[model samples]
Target: MRLRWPVALLVTLLVVVLGTLMGSRTPAEAAKKITIKDSMGRTVRVPCPPQRIVEVNGDVAELICALGDAGKIVGASSYTLQDKFFTSRLKKAQDVGKSFTPSVEKILALKPDVVFGYGKFLKPEIIAQLERAGVPVVLLDCYKIKTMAEDIRTLGVILNRQKEAAAYIAYFEKYRKLFADRVKKIPVNRRPRVYLEQYTDYTLSGPGSGGAELLDGVGARNIGAGLRVPYPKISPEWLLAQNPDVIIKACGSSITSGYGEKPDAMAKKRAEMMRRPGWSRIAAVRQGKVYMLSSEIFTGPRAIVGMAYMAKWLYPQLFKDVNPAAIHKEMLKKFHGLELKGAYVYP
Candidate 1:
């Protein structure tokens, strides 16, 4: 005898059958997810090998490009759009706006699989907003020397470019160890006292900052290391009183010195620093030890390149064999697939 099923039961059975036939995924396909603990210490589950990405920070975007996945970038911040290297590669990407204030609607419209941002700079609200929209946001700051290796490795895993990431890390370690081995041998008293200025005059890079770490990595004693804040502004008299043995100015976008630019702006910045009132008595000025470094190299993923220059400037005899320009060119060629054509340091 045939039995008649209840309408509700029949509907449930039909729905289940249709769902299995139309929406079921294989185990391998269902498991295509990666769990990542971002720089902010938040665990995020991202789709494996994100095909479309929105990178809000230029430094982080540079890392993505270095990983050989520049083609996957679908949206970028204004900073990345303005960068010659990024513009050349990400010609088809849409600019969502500034890194600090990205347009959520614009990013959502792109249907990105993942978004990259700097934990320290991008607001938590923006990250939350993206997450609510079913988009994953990974905070990775590629600037700090201490965490750079881990950050790159994480990116490598997320992008399935483990080989490229390992190579990049090895390259960074080569120079890092070169500087570390040589710097460690020098006595503490022999290390130069350095005053590293930020983008603005009288603004200093203090403890816990990437700039301060760069100086420390090269065995230079940062005069402002004892400051309570990361970036503190001091009076001119205070700067003169420090009498730092070496003065290094970090120039940002205000001074063009990186990627298809001339060294004239850096030269002018150096000369202006040299002409500061009462700075003539400073040891750095008296001995012609004042130098200018573009923020492009000193504050981001290529900070080691800046460190190489700093090492040479502070201890010319010790780092004579270390050519920062050569290293810069090699990095550009090997990682970013670009030729070195701009001035990163000045005479």
Candidate 2:
């Protein structure tokens, strides 16, 4: 039996209304917006899975590669290209200029889903340009020991690689706890007075600095902790007075890279440290307790590796079995799928 025209018309209207409602919900369901506050405390709404990304910081980009989302990265900064480990995988990504001063034109050209940058490094105008172009940008603090893990987790969620991110976080926590547990066993009086020399002779990282955070994590004392500034240029006489029990010279822009491999160069540098006016009288020099560290090992997620080395250095007997080199190899191999060879630390 055929339905009446009025009833048929009403049925047709209901069907059309239901279809419209379903169609409207499809886009929202396909890609949901997730609200997250960046390190700068700016509220942001990003797509659940960002397919195209631009990471300005090499360390943050490294973490992205480690989380198995390197394909998602469409643009990167200068440092990422210079990184030997990351060069091959990220070679295809567009060079977005310096870590701090990326080309707004290039970034706009890529039409990335989102852009990640270091809060301290990125310029205000660049961020403003991206924001004005309707490109979502999230600034992060990649180096701080307190928030590094959380930052990784946040990236994992944004990239939809939570499982991979959790694995990395777990590895970081394990090593972090290992150092903390062993260091805690030592008494406060036993903690060594350490001077963290940053690349240059007198430049030091004190309290509130990245080096200070690592030393604190490993339960070591920063002799420069008394300094008012985070990165201060102290006088050689002041260092002589502090008489650090241990001296860790960090290799970075101010110093030549790959010098750690050259025994003669390293010896010359070490000799120079020993010959500093009144340095011979200092406890660290007198006891021959000096070490060379690489900045790469102490930045970003790799800082935990630096802490392990410090723990072993600070208390050899307790962390005798903790091999930082082996851990470094495993982390790079397992997370990054790269077999990198280099000397990051030296006696």
Candidate 3:
């Protein structure tokens, strides 16, 4: 038998033995993992410094891009691709379809090491499907002010970009403290009554909404806070009765107001809102306090930028030295590596 041994058979046996020895150190053994709790409170084990990422949430994508890990993204939601910043940074990332209903097959095809999604939009079944296929899904809602810092910290740990994350947190805390200190000085009676409308007409953002949280953070009273639903459609009569001191309409992508975009569309929306029947009697309308805010800033890590603008709008005298536009410009240049050239707030 030894004399009759074929060269190909010997080679095959040698290769199999070598593979067996090396296979003892499996891929899981070779890759290190870290355990962290996602925004949804699920304990997930994700590879440290994930090389390939599929980010379904645009907000998280913004944070990832800001952290200077844009090159790690292999796939992104369609909404993320539409954003100027994300589009510029993630030009090569594959589109994984809609944020709410991302294509599982498309995401799997990208072979991402981890997936990041908004807690609200990512269904449980979708998460299970991804996990079953050996993909880890990390839900981080970067839009909420309350959890944004912690979310960023967790994200830093995952991306191995702790330094960048800390820097952003410091920037965030600076304005957060500034807003808190100045807003606390105003008397409750003097606080501006703000009516925050969503992209849809008559749809008001209530307690659970980011818009409501922003208004509350800036020491303004959200007229719709008492509503049971997060987004409630109210009658025009009810809005008229509120007589808000300030009106802020959140314009979505449909209205177009962001980097390199014009303000004409936002201006048109604001004018239409002001022209609504019986709107002239509203304090906000009469005093020209109606403002249109681009959703780009108001609902993500950049919400602080939107807060700066709101602070200036709600109390011009107090925040006179605080230039929201300058802060916004700095944020874009420092974090996203973009020059500010678009209108975010409408006159």
- Candidate number achieving the greatest TM-score relative to the actual structure: 3
TM-score of each: 0.90, 0.85, 0.91
lDDT of 3 by residue, 1-347 (tens): 34788989999999999888878653433578999999889999998888889999988988999999999898999988987766678989999998989999999998888999989779789989999999999999999888889999999999889999999999987897788888987788899899988989999989888888888788998898788988899999999999999999998878988878899999999999999999999999999999999988886899988999999999889889998889988988998878888889999
The better-scoring model by lDDT among 1 and 3 is: 3
C-alpha lDDT of all candidate models, in order: 0.89, 0.81, 0.90
Error of 1 at 166 (Å): 0.6
**Superposing all C-alpha atoms, what RMSD in Å does each candidate have to the true structure?**
5.0, 4.9, 4.7
By lDDT rank, best first, the candidates go 3, 1, 2
User: Would you list the rank order by TM-score, best first?
Assistant: 3, 1, 2
Q: Residue 242 error for model 2, in Å?
A: 0.9
Model number with the top lDDT: 3
Clashes of each: 0, 0, 0
Model 3 alpha-carbon miss at residue 270, Å: 0.7
User: Higher lDDT: candidate 2 or 3?
Assistant: 3
